[model samples]
Target chain A: MKKNYSNEDLHSEQGATISGQQQKAIVCNGLTKQFGSFRAVDNISFDVNEGEIFGFLGANGAGKTTAMRILCGLSYPTSGEATVAGFDVYKQQERIKKNIGYMSQKFSLYDNLTLLENIEFYGGVYGVSRSEIKIRSSDLISTLGLQKEAHKLVSELPLGWKQKLAFSVAIFHRPKIVFLDEPTGGVDPVTRRQFWDMIYEAAANGITVFVTTHYMDEAEYCNRISVMVDGRVEALDTPANLKKQYKTNSMNDVFYELARGAKRADN
Target chain B: MNSVEVINIVKTYGEVKAVKNVSFEVAKGELFGLIGPDGAGKTSLFRVLTTLLLADSGTATVEGFDVVKDYREIRNRVGYMPGRFSLYQDLTVEENLSFFATVFGTTIRENYDLIKDIYEQIAPFNSRRAGKLSGGMKQKLALCCALIHKPDVLFLDEPTTGVDVVSRREFWEMLNKLKKQGITIVVSTPYMDEASLCDRIALIQDGTVMSINSPDRIVKNFPKTLFAAKANNIYKLLQDLRRNSEMESCYAFGEYIHFTVKADDADIVRISQIAERENHDGLEVKQVIPGIEDCFIRLTLDSGQKIMDRKK
Candidate 1:
């Protein structure tokens, strides 16, 4: 069920084909995004390997959202090159959008829509066949233990349940990559763990998971992490290596050490 | 006397019970935390205590004023930073602070010392619009506005939810300083790590109070001998350990898996041996001190299971 898009045959003409067969899911080279005079995202770059859960960490106003939007092809980068799921962020945004799933910091599902209706709507948007949608929707609902509340409007669900449903729908299209922006903000620790479980499941199924979160504990779960400080990647490494480098036991300490040294107060 | 007391308060919205028979007391000038997941009634209880929402039953008092009867006095004497950002978006940072100060019949300069540390960080950007400020700056501004009145108590509902680690730490540091000035502080957050920063915390779940204690005491009271187990193929290790009859409960904890032994006498040696027998490579097992989060999960699960068993 895990489809690997590493093969050259799947490469479209919109982006440069990755030469090596290392199968990187996302590649960025000096990616930069600027809003007016402020370089919200300075020259920054990183690669996300297939099936790897990449954790993007930063303080508020640290340009994480800007870089993520650029990577997701929602916004254009000022300079540098990046490819997502083998599609150019600049030239093949349509193809990239079709292949990527995104869950934002805020709830994305329609509040008035029932749980089932929201799932069906997203399925339709992704062009999932009706028969496939039925099977997948049932599977998702069951997996999230939402069978009893399937007909309930999203507005009526608890915050944790809504988050779980939003995540389920994000990956409903079976995209090769999924982007979660602070998916667990204000969520309880138990529900946060459950959300990470979903992320692990998605990554295990070959979907590259890219997530940005303020919770240091959640950042530790990622296979590799990038800490953006003042619009630049202060460090990018395994949580273990980062901890060792900073001589800290927790990701919270590591993030504080890097982010506190930031010279700019506003970004 | 308790600075804040919640006596079996219950709040309901139609069929959903947002806060159910919740009772607690916070000593004056103590930094108290109401910790829980979202929809766990932390906000509902805060609303009741802050005099924003009236409880359907029971009663709560803040600084000797009944929440229902002295709503006006409570409103005047308490500073509240709602979980969501609620500052005037169009007003400049300076303007927002001045406006809040004026509404309270005071001036920012009059109470400047109270929020000096927090306000100074965003002071350079005072001219920036509240909506235009970064999340950290906006929070600092919000805190400044909340403190400009120099109230006797502060009600901060999930103030650090979206704040970055550095800013979050700074915000708590500011809170500690404020506490030293003899102001009672009640803050709510979803982050269990932040629970450790509080003097005492009330863990809430499903609209019920699960436990209330200091963070260290809560961790000290964790009933299980928890082990931090890690190995290559960590997910597979989780599955293998779950099959082990000696393992009581296992849950993923970051890079390592946290599991408790079913038998009280089982030690790390036995756990490592099991991992070894299962052919798990690079097996590392260590007895680790459980944090506030571990305590929270255990307590919440125990309560949930108890309810289920009673239903059965």
Candidate 2:
């Protein structure tokens, strides 16, 4: 019964019409990316509803980064169709970039810049007006309670504080969608929770959240998750439904079940 | 005799005390873990014991040799894989592994059996440049290089920080194999779940050791009975739970909120009543055993309170 329900959920959105209501923030149909003879992203299809928190999970070298890059407009797909924030991945890459925020653990805010300065720089880069950037940045600094340290260089702050600031800066322009790639990689447990609360807040405010993480517990927090193995999405469903289908107690088991059979080694 | 010993080691950089009088010991052939988040001074402690950096005070010994006085001897007896990828990016996988082997006055053939299980996985890409390999492949090669010398002790810093679940599980399995060979391994990781895999762990935070014991013992030592609660809206439930005066602390843990109450004997029924009063839908609450993360969080909070009290 659970298997049938999951299959229905997966197929219900595929090739579904986008009406005035029930808008989708992202839509991909048979998306494929090939490099020479290697297909990094096999024919994959999924849709993320507006204001939904979607988790994109995969093993190392499973083509998750490639798929994300195509969706974020950083790279073009070899074939198949994908649209982000109602903009085409191929033709409207610039439009997609303008409406999305991207943050990765390896790269986020500028280290040399002060907290306030980093906010202003990212705000300006997103095309927010100078006057608005001024007011919002101050409000942001106070909201984060970094008032005394607002002028201090970002490099001086602890890892937790830097991550929070980087996240706040990513969404400063109020982009429609935010992409976080392993945002809480090495963050402390408490700080990691605080970061998730920020994600929850962003989702509450009608902004779509698309994230990738290695923590299986975090996978349970997503409204729906798609697990990729060997460039193919092996499972896509709500955490509860996936668990029932796989007869497991957690997302970790579900992932191991699907990925264990993968012929492609992590390379 | 202990394979590694750190006696009140203190390391500072200018105004920051990166490692504050931290001390721990690892038994010979034991899989010990230094578990903490970033900037928790795991690296500083590892560096001091590995003889790469000198502690401002205190002493450390690896393989029965003083870290400071017998630095060269300690260096030769231990293998260290830093947090960052320190291998030569321009060098091929084979080149990097062979170079490390030669540096330690050994060759790949000399200790081929020690690294055979790990190196064989990446041997297919032996000619590929280190930079060209994928993240998982790079880590595998790094492990192979670290083991090629067949050192008596191994120090791995955050080896699985960004690795996926499948790869991480595989890595742990490999570690277990190495342990059977009688090589003392000390690994550091931000992932709390990995703590249980170690024979013993030292939970460090803010440059101090919070606790050191087997994972089961640490979890068993949780001072409060924990509860896991769920509702239709987890975030709303979290906010509502925090507002309740009866609750001492509440944090989101995956699908549910794991919390503790101020009063003793706070069972599932009492927590359910609190959630229902908040007008939550589909409320479910139950008592659950604490994990390493829960213990870590509780310890960190307690230490933080201690610091606040000291200031007062």
Candidate 3:
């Protein structure tokens, strides 16, 4: 099982004090994915420590979604190697699928389905026990404040509430690592703050989180983040160090500094 | 003349109340903003204000014309670009601008000077299909189409939501230029930091006004002393600080925790000591300016609506 970690811890030691620790949950080496003439994910290499909320950031076409898709075994990598949960992504895709949960950028719950039904469908498809799903669904709905809305259809709920509910369902199965693509894109600040709290709780409970977001502010929430630009990992570090290196006050500026040219260069 | 006003306006999509009893006024030539995340009723508010959709109840007047009764007149006087790129994707840049201008019973060449700054950048790509252009170009073209009519008021809903930083900055610059030309503008955005650019904003959430004031005044209203403290392990530091009895509330703020101390609780000495005891490395502390994010965090905590007991 992975242990949860905040961004500060991974940043403290800085500069590779501990490399190849046995506890590292994810390792990527020369990972590359290509689509004919276009390279979606170029030669990128990084490791996600056990239970760390790793943030993947870039412009709209920076290949962030592609990298995560490859990690989750949803797509094939063109070259290089990645070991998720210590299993080779290419050779053990089925094993990776079994152990990981994925929530897409458009992870809209079945709108017409009741909250409980949505949870049951995801759990049932994942093969979680009926008893476990029942117990877990109740705990999740309560924590996310969906008690009154549990019986309501997802389409009827407000977008913020739906966002929280979707996230809750994403992690309900206790997957070793959960990959989220822009989970907080269009949510209110209050709901965003609450969503981060849920993420903290998940990390505390020993679940590794890999998330992608364009909202630079949300980048502050990750334990460690990597800037993917034009199919390459441009910068990967704790938020503080990245800000220092980029000489910027906010992640918005840092992202611009990293992505400004690489983005244009790619196109 | 007042730019726009809504009186007890109500909008509903069947049983759901997207915009509920909303009312606000935008003075002439002012940059008023409707700030909220998705489904905070931002787009719906804009649709009603721009006269795209009629309010179910109450009244709205844009440039002194009713949105329902005087919609054709109101439509002739307002420039609007929806949240999505609603321009004709099949048309070229020039064609789209000309089409919009023709729809308003005008011509782009007649108002080319007004959109000269934005239209010039994409004029070289005037023949490019709207869909073939890059995100930034698409935004510029959209602005051009909206400006072709040279309407007295402008309504932009989440124009920067999906664009890159460079493009977003460019779009804001265009808005500033348009504002200077005395075109009253009401824009909506989910990003709080952009609130500072507005003359006044209604910080909304869940379809209710949280606060309405300039960004500077809003930040000035944030109560309590804030500090940015960081160590080697920031995650554990937050968990550790949140548990410490001395601090009132501590949450992650960018590179450090934007924490507020309990009144008369303890000084900075005690705060650093707690951090040090936890072996938080390189712990640096500073007095920093409160930003929109800080104000937002304070609003939730100071509202006295505690969801759960503070972990302290």
Candidate 4:
């Protein structure tokens, strides 16, 4: 909640330099997660500042999700130290869980529940009082312009609306950080744009957003991005800097250049 | 000769009209794209043409054989990859490929050259169960299985929907190579960016074909003066721009909003003035080209307007 570094300071911290201010919402040092003989996340290190949208990118087999699971306290890292919201991942995973919100590629909400009920359920799970849930649910419905569909089952809604509602419910507790994994996979462009608008709103309100997406255009929306290839962070910088670094005009091209050279597969 | 043809194909399920009088032709050796969002009738049309399902009306053919009368022949000449993963997950990669090849009364060595590029990517893990493969590897294996028979035509439905960007690009490259091999390929994808990789793309929505042309022609046909506009408060900028009388449709595109104006340069000045009035700082606007997705949206919106007008 307190600011100890400017945006420029965080940008400098991203490229291999740490100031040790403990101001980052997320800090990873030598993080590794191995499965059998394969290292899914191999000694990755990075820092995500408060309220910044950090884009995590990689191919399908790349270790982005392993690292994310470690950060969210869902999976134990094989080795290395990491702190999320100033709580140690290994020792204070419960604390880390309480402070972070996660939205997987699949919507975590119950499809049969009504919009308001879904909101109430997630808010309750996050320990919000019933009285506060009423006010927050109504505000969320109005904010998303779902007043008409507020009582409808999530299954009856369009894919776009369901995704938006899932996102709103994910952040119902107003966690300090939110992890979004491919939040707009199959939606139309107009709907994808609207979802990104929701993301921008969340980030603007000081929620540290860590998102992974396959859409290169969406990658450009992030404040900074870290790309992984074969379980290593092959590139980390702003989208513009990445484009310059790879000598490519688009993020799609940059991704191809990094991922094409990787020899590992089926691990 | 056309490798595939659909003439006024109409398919329905109960109250839902999945494919409404859709028709298209794929020339031999052509790589065609069926581009649209979810439930756009891509799968239905593909099923009809591939002889897996019957059409309510009209006709379709593959390799000069009727879908109804020559269903057997069509099935033999065309390979299909359904939207969902259909490979046996419990089976090893080698087993799945060999099974597909045997189903067609062929062996892996018989059509090895057809799928050599893709098969090699997953061959190292041939002994591993298909379930253990990653999303990209599974995709490559599914593609190899489809090509093992060396079908004259291939139909893929949303093959790269959930795959990462790198794999999506590689899949397109493989498609291009197959196209050079003279295999008529028709693939569907929800990602609009992949539409550019096809020689020609058919933009469909609500079971209706909105436009069918090269990606460049579709972009060129967008009839509005498009602009990419941005301000400090992007959400507010969108709200303000939508409320402006001179503004046409406006939607967010990445960091900026892609919008259209009523007239020419005057609209830019008006937009800047509106941004200033709304207390938006660092306002900027630039002329931008429309992509296939943008054109698809505009076409669908116009079609909706026409339908409403007819009802009125």
Best by lDDT: 2
Alpha carbon lDDT at A260, candidate 3: 72
Clash pairs (backbone) in predicted model 4: none
Clashing pairs in 3: A7-A223, A8-B234, B232-B281
| Model 1 residue pairs with clashes | none
**Highest-scoring model, TM-score:** 1
Interface RMSD of 3: 4.6
**Residue runs of model 3 more than 4 Å from their true location after superposition:** A1-21, A263-267, B240-249, B261-285, B300-312
Q: Where does candidate 4 stray beyond 4 Å? A: A1-23, B229-245, B264-284, B303-312
Query: Which tens-of-lDDT digit does each residue in B138-229 have in candidate 3?
Result: 88888888888889999998998866676677789889999999999999998887888999988776566677788889889877767778
Model 4 chain A poorest ten-residue lDDT run: A11-20
**lDDT per residue as tens, model 1, A110-185:** 9999999999999889767788789889988877667888899999987777887888899998887899998988
lDDT against the true structure, per candidate, is 0.84, 0.87, 0.79, 0.84
Q: In terms of lDDT, which candidate is stronger, 1 or 3? A: 1
C-alpha DockQ of every model: 0.47, 0.38, 0.32, 0.30
Displacement of the residue B173 alpha carbon in candidate 1, Å: 0.8
Ranking by lDDT: 2, 1, 4, 3
In candidate 3, position A69 carries an lDDT of 83
lDDT of 1 by residue, B1-312 (tens): 888999999899999999999999999999999998778898888888888888999989988999988899988999999988999999999999999999999998899989888887788888988888877788888888989999988999998887788988988888888999999999999888889889999999989988899988888899988898888777778778877777666777877888787788877787677668878778888989998888887886676532111111
Tens-digit lDDT track of model 4 for B1-312: 799888999999897888999999999999999998887899999888888899999999899999999999988899999999999999999999999999999999998998988888888889999998888888899999999899999999999988777678888889999999999999999999899999899998879999999999999988977888777666678777777777667777766778876666545566566556756777788878898878976886677532111111
Q: Encode model 2's per-residue lDDT on A1-267: one tens digit a residue.
A: 012223423332342333213588898999999999999999999999988999999887789989999999999999999888777899878777877899999899899999988998898787777887888888888887789998999999988888888888988877778999999989988888888888998999988999999999999889999999989998899999999999989888888888877766454
Instruction: Give the interface RMSD of each candidate.
Output: 4.9, 4.9, 4.6, 6.1
Candidate 3 matches the true fold with a TM-score of: 0.88
TM-score of each: 0.93, 0.93, 0.88, 0.88
